[model samples]
Target chain A: MSQLDQSGAVPAAAENAAPAVSLSGERVLRVIVPLVMLAALVGLWAWYVQAYNIPKYILPSPALVAQSLVNDWPILGAALLVTLKITFAALAIALVGGVVLAVLLVQSKWIELAISPYMVILQVTPIVAIAPLILIYAPSTQVALLVCAWIVAFFPVLSNTTQGLKSTDHNLLNLFELYGASPLQTLFLLKLPAALPYFLAGLRIAGGLALIAAVVAEFAAGSAGAGSGLAFRLLESQYRLNIPRLFAALLLLCATGVAIYGATSLISHLMLRRWHESAIRREN
Target chain B: MSSAVSMNAVAPSGKPIVRLEHVSKTFSNGTIALKDMSLTIGEGEFVSLLGPSGCGKSTALRIMAGLGDASTGRVEWPTMPHDASGKPEREIGFVFQEPTLMPWATVYKNVWLPLRLHGVSKAAARERVMSALEMVGLDKFADSYPRELSGGMKMRVSIARALVTRPRVLLMDEPFAALDEITRQKLNDDLLRLWEQFGWTVVFVTHSVFESVYLSSRIVVMAARPGRVIDEMEVDAPHPRGVAFRTSLEYGEFCRRASQSLLSAIGANDHL
Candidate 1:
């Protein structure tokens, strides 16, 4: 029997009035409200700079920050590229390593028990404390930053994917058993596909975390040779008392974080749109 | 009726198809699912294991299919012309209560499962798959996914999958229990037609008294709590049973008698 009601309009009406009430409208509000708030904050800053007649060194105006961004475009852009390179490299490593660890964890209980405690310890430990030690032990600062970021991003994917792989439907599992499918066949066909939603969710979270870890690690472990990332630029600008340049660098970092979140979410949506409820919710 | 036909009676080609002797199953959880169950389904007999929920009817079917172990029994079968004696026979096909069609696979591929498992080439199995789909009247919907179909259509695909293997015996576990009254009756008729067409013996498990009465040549009534067969009834109704047969006075009387027997087998405490 069909579960669809006679009046198709009723479900739609309920959906509109209930949880999705503000969801779509709130997305527009989210963008509009934040932009309005940013404008007001900038307006207040500009007024304060002129009213109090504060020096540019103390608190630069938004215009001054824009000018500083233009003036140091070449150097700052290079540093931005460096940070992006490290972030992406670390993310790639984390993705591969995390999935392998998750697969191992699923395959053997002993390995999961032995390694899980260390993974937790790695996650909880501060990056600042480990960066210098990694820098000293590792050959280069770039490698050290990559390792730190990998450590930060690895756990979420590993934990999420492991749980997803194990969360297959019992009825479906019995069906597979009835067919006389081998363990490996079941894992590849059923477990892997079932785990995809969770893995994508974890990847989205890890994308932002990986970027944060890259920046944080650079702050602790000094940048070598070609002048490191946005974090180094931030610290240098602060030391030089270049307020406008510091604000511009901070803006870039925030933009990078937002981009990572948006891009990963898009990837997740594209991959899961056909079968998953999460993607279906977004469709309406 | 007193002819004393050989328990291992040879088919027209001189071969006994399936034999089960003293089959019983006790789950590791200590539930006695079946007790001293023995039945030899001939070439094309439609035998229904009519029982209540916990009567081990399904368990008995599974044991015949080799999907589960009989804690204490032996099942023997003559090696078909295509099979070697050294190799285990894989001719039995099973249809579960829930249409266990693969959600990911299309109807065509789902029906092709048994053949694929035996390493049969897809190209060679294509005709057989289509024929099986045709039998279920679902050949047109072969490319459709299980989720795209109705409950009745999905169950039809499940039956098609079982039939595709050209299995000698079909073991069904309440295959029509999930469908509506109309759909269930239609499927029951369709199932018997398939059984007759292929000349395949069916060991059907069902809770419905009317269903067993309508489709079975012989009905084995079972009782729960260490489930065992309590009574056996042989329906003398002729083959090619039509829709009108279900509404006939004889069919209703048979159903009533079967229901009474089932109620008594369930014990005096339980109400229908």
Candidate 2:
């Protein structure tokens, strides 16, 4: 029943300073174990490729895919740029549309009530089912792809920001009233700042969704005309029985997703690092 | 009963700064927050509404501050002689229980809120903001955000924001109730100093019997259920009440009398 030391440090004067080294050693083990496990998986994949005599079309080796990615760099790089453009265009439209919708909804409860059910329907309905219909009616494949992605990514921002705007504290509202602040002032100063954390969270979620939506829409629409992207390249590689090329296109897509996530989280951190609880340091 | 001199004495002749005549408030949900209450606060009197919770003290203060309209009575203010249009009066400042600061705003910007709302340019409002911050002893922290400050400091910023308008009357609803004892005591002293220096009427609401005795020249005890004023006590102690006076027997006697009146009000409220 001795009192445990709560300083979160080992006594430097004690012989048990060895525990600090042991703790850091445990941290190293924690990192190394995961790396070793990943290495084992890679070794097993290589071994299986050699032992099973699987055809390249059936299952290409990671090294072969990497090689093919380098070999077909010009085509894949063009596809990557096209895919990035679609993703960013769709995201920009979604951001603007979602924020406008959120402001409309917050300003008028009747509008929110009338529009929310349809917004939910759009959110829940499959984008794949809608993409072909959009392609036919949209006049342009690029517009169709952008619309599909915007539909997919816009709801989270709208819903999150709406909730955030509505979640301003009652006391704060009273303070605004006491100061004779107009509705616009209250919205800009109090509601918008209060809603920022929620909006950033929604943006992070929407960023990844926008990338997925762009890829999914391209997959469904067959990338006809000048709207070709990574998904079109994936389909093209598959049709040609170029498994390595397909894998390469997929790697690009995965990298895009990861990059979108990383960039959004960085932006969220940068914008919120000052005043938000989500970004505040917990320790003194 | 209808003598002119007595009626004039009852209702100060120097153009009432704020007059609540038979004011009543009843929520739509059938809760009567305030019963018919009549009160007039003079030009520079420091009055405290002393009551327990649910007594509608805050409601009363809000009515005076023009945040809420009384359901059954008229609130009147004397037309300022200097006003050209002879329209409704302006310049009332309100401080709530919570600091209610904009977290994203620096202290200087927070204090500038009222003036900014009134369409005062930043350059024009800068001096007033600085003076208000200086009055609250927060001149050094004007650039700091509310989140970076302690609770007491945040409340100081709230006070500074309220004072930046230089309102003729200051309505405070338990602004120091959330602070620690030491901070609360210090603020009470500082508030009186500011009140004396500005010569502005203060209609403060508080639950603390001791605070009402120490800070207010006049205490109005209120009861709930149908919130109404039960008694009014006058503290004839001189201004610039020091720390020594707080520890003095006279302070204790004043607190006891105020507490007795407050308890009786609460007791009367309980019977309802």
Candidate 3:
């Protein structure tokens, strides 16, 4: 009687453990749902423009925007290349600078106390507010725009990496000490590896911010030439009242931002999939 | 109290590995973690610093490991080889209460850490790392990360990491305290086996009386509230202690006496 009761009790938990939906079905729903929503939104937009017979200058139709994108490909494409160059250059510099600064700051309390306040001051002040000063001092408009993007993107990396360095496991530190590890060894082998997840997290956030800052700084600089970025084309298109070209440029910027985010997320996932909680897949 | 029970055989017959003489540690905030705690761990001895929480047993173990220094008195390692800097070489390995494995690293890499720090190349240290993992029965899980393993397996990885250096002195601060009873017992047996095979002088810090009795040839019972040693007792039972020893009448008697000592140590703090 007791054995039968025990056997009967096991099935409730077993039933609860079973997943409600198949894994593949759930995965298919995730991808399909978003594409469906996007299609519906685009269809509504196209219908609304057609019904109103809106002027191209006021609000370009999806077909007109697509046509403009094809017609203005040379100009807009070159501008995109310029903007991407500035964004990536600034981000690379920021990664190196932020990580080095964080490592130096963590080395001594006094160094951190003296320097961290300045970093905070820089972070809190608006980038546009400082863009004019940067433009005046910089040798070229490209350098000025790069500086602005770097200033915006670097703070998160510095702060997050600093936090990661400081939060290293105390026992592990002691273990390193017990092993008679040198300071450089501790920094590279212990602290750096421990701080990787935080650095990657900061990088993901900074990726989007870098692109935004690059465009905003260009808007502030308002420098117009063949070497000008997408921001300049947007301004030029607006001034000419070529709203279709402006919409096409705007669409390109949105795609670039999404691409940057997706790339950063993929990097973070690939780096951390083996160990980090956020990246690892759970059984259920 | 009985013929089998010996009074304070604190120092074993072998040469001393490390000695803490009148060591006391007070933090900057003025809390005395340890007070006048003097103990000597001889070579090839398994000594458990048995006490309740806040008793400075872990503090004492840390001092022994040279992770922290005593505010007063001194810790001496008389027999160990010294490095070029006139300090003792990395002759000691420590296992913390937690597994403390590098989460990002594979089991093979985590176990490889101590040797890597000592400037040993991967190719050179590979054999020893594998052997250490084999000792802990986790050789098959070498490529797995700490997150992938069970609690016991992670602890085993930690043990393997500590052993990779092949240190003469092994210091553990309640290393198995978080494990389930079955896992803990299994680890206890594995640890004893390693100690016997390696002849390592182990200073194990634990709060459990039963655990202290089971593992240690000598048990140092300590009191908290300023953290001082109150009693020392030796378990005269023979080694290769396993399930039969765990359930034996002799083991029960040792546990009973150790429990009494621990209770009175706690009782003494209550009186204060």
Candidate 4:
């Protein structure tokens, strides 16, 4: 895609040849199609529950879930705040730590050789398995949950950023050397900017994983109280058999996941829209 | 080859600014990229290392630029200025086969890079960067990103970046090899204009016989398979050579001789 843009004329000609109406149609379809599919799926699920007269505990109707969503807003909202706090905090920490570690690792092959094995172990080990250990060792339940999320989210940023740093255009590296740039100058002006698209890509992946890790860690900790996240509330509702409220909490989790994805994608787009291929909008 | 070594001292008028004395480069994989290559580039001269692929033309250029070290022999910059460290200062600009601009940077910032690395602030480098862009006819595009430009435009940006520091010598390794013929010819003319205007010694590496004949003051034809210089010829054409020269009898004659040298260079490898 970047190659196409770099060559310029061929893609420009192709872009101009594309009809304007179809381009606008594509823009419209992008949003409308997904919404239409979502509405249809919800309608089908609601209809099936109503027609079958399914028990509320067995399968709460969409309307009943919506009612529960409104009625239990204060409780669910607070739980959501707790989960969001953990997720964002973990993601922020992972982003900074991961990038710093990646830069250090790329500085020497020996450093990378020493540290990458441990990073791989962290990435491969299930958060569920580690969450209990973290909970036992951590000073607080929140700290444990944050640790779990960080473990899950940090690897992609580190690995992808490392690759990006190493993959800087060889010619540019030589050029920088020719100009007598210092190591720090090369890192900041060249490698960091070159690695940004990769970092953002990792951030997008880490964003989703952070939320997942937060939920999973909360589940594993299972500490129920006013400070508990939605995951605990989910367990509590399940044990109580309040299915509609469970569905409401589940809906909130799904919404939060989408929001995180959307937010990260927006960040990636805004940062890279002017240059990176993945972020640049191509007409078809 | 022995005769060509003697010819290394035969600069037209100006002093020998850069001299490669019996330089040979062997890669770690044990491929000898260059073997006993001897060439002399005079001040204000436009010399092209013309050869087929694997002829180590780019390698020789890189060695001169101090981007690579020769396994045997030495590169001497007899006329370059010395820094406080007593080492000859790196007073060379290089353009790769690819434009190689940072895609994220605007054209202005891309041109400002070498100056930035030299500890010149953006405000200090602004006028120089703009003038470099103006030389490439891209001053209006200072704010544009590389992706927003065409192939020729990007290459122009690369040239601007190389020129921003006002180096004493410009080393180009097939910088226009990827461009279309029309754009290539236009750049060839523009490059000649710059060379004439600044009087910077230029060592352009290219495989095209016609391009070498058209643009060079001297063409050093090289052969592949442990690449070595095989022949040297002077164009000796008058300055301000343009489209008229490209279609002239003298241009055709130079092109024919350069083409024969190039074909023989390739044929020499085929026999081995």
Q: Pick the DockQ winner.
A: 4
Candidate 3 docking quality: incorrect, acceptable, medium or high: acceptable
* DockQ leaderboard ranking: 4, 3, 2, 1
Weakest ten-residue segment in model 4 chain A by summed lDDT: A1-10
Ranking by TM-score: 4, 3, 2, 1
Report each candidate's C-alpha RMSD, comma-separated, in the order given.
5.4, 6.4, 4.8, 3.2
- In the range B1-272, model 3's lDDT, one tens digit per residue, is 21112345455648988888889999999889999877777888999999989999999998877777889998899988887754567778889999998999999999999999988998999999999988888887799878767778788889889888888988899999998887788788889988888889999999988888989999999888888888889897998888888899999999999999888889977655
- For model 4, how does the per-residue alpha-carbon lDDT over A148-192 read when each residue is reduced to its tens digit? 999999999999999999999998999898888889999999999
Give one digit per residue, the lDDT tens place, for model 2 in B93-201. 7888999887767889889988988789889999999999888888877887676777777888899988998888888999999988977887888898899889888
Most lDDT-accurate candidate: 4
Q: Write the per-residue lDDT of candidate 2 for residues A148-255, one digit (tens) a residue.
A: 999999999999999989999888888777666779998888888888888999999999999999999999988743448889999999999999999988988898
- Model 4 over residues B1-272: C-alpha lDDT tens digits? 46644554345448888888899999999999999987778888899999988989999998887787889998898888866634356578889999999999999899999999989999999999999988888887799888878988899889999888888999999999999987888788889988888999999999898898888999999999979998888999999889899999999999998888788788887665
Chain B only: TM-score of model 2: 0.91
Q: A216-261, model 3: which lDDT tens digit per residue? A: 9999999888889999999999999999999999999999999999
For model 2, the stretches where C-alpha displacement exceeds 4 angstroms are A1-54, A224-226, A281-284, B1-15, B79-90
Tell how far residue A26 is off in model 1, in angstroms: 10
DockQ of 4: 0.50
> Alpha-carbon interface RMSD of model 4?
6.2
* Clash-forming residue pairs, model 1: none
Per-residue error for B30 in candidate 2, Å, reads 1.0
For residue A98, model 2's alpha carbon misses the true position, in angstroms, by 0.8
Question: Which pairs in model 2 have colliding backbones?
Answer: none
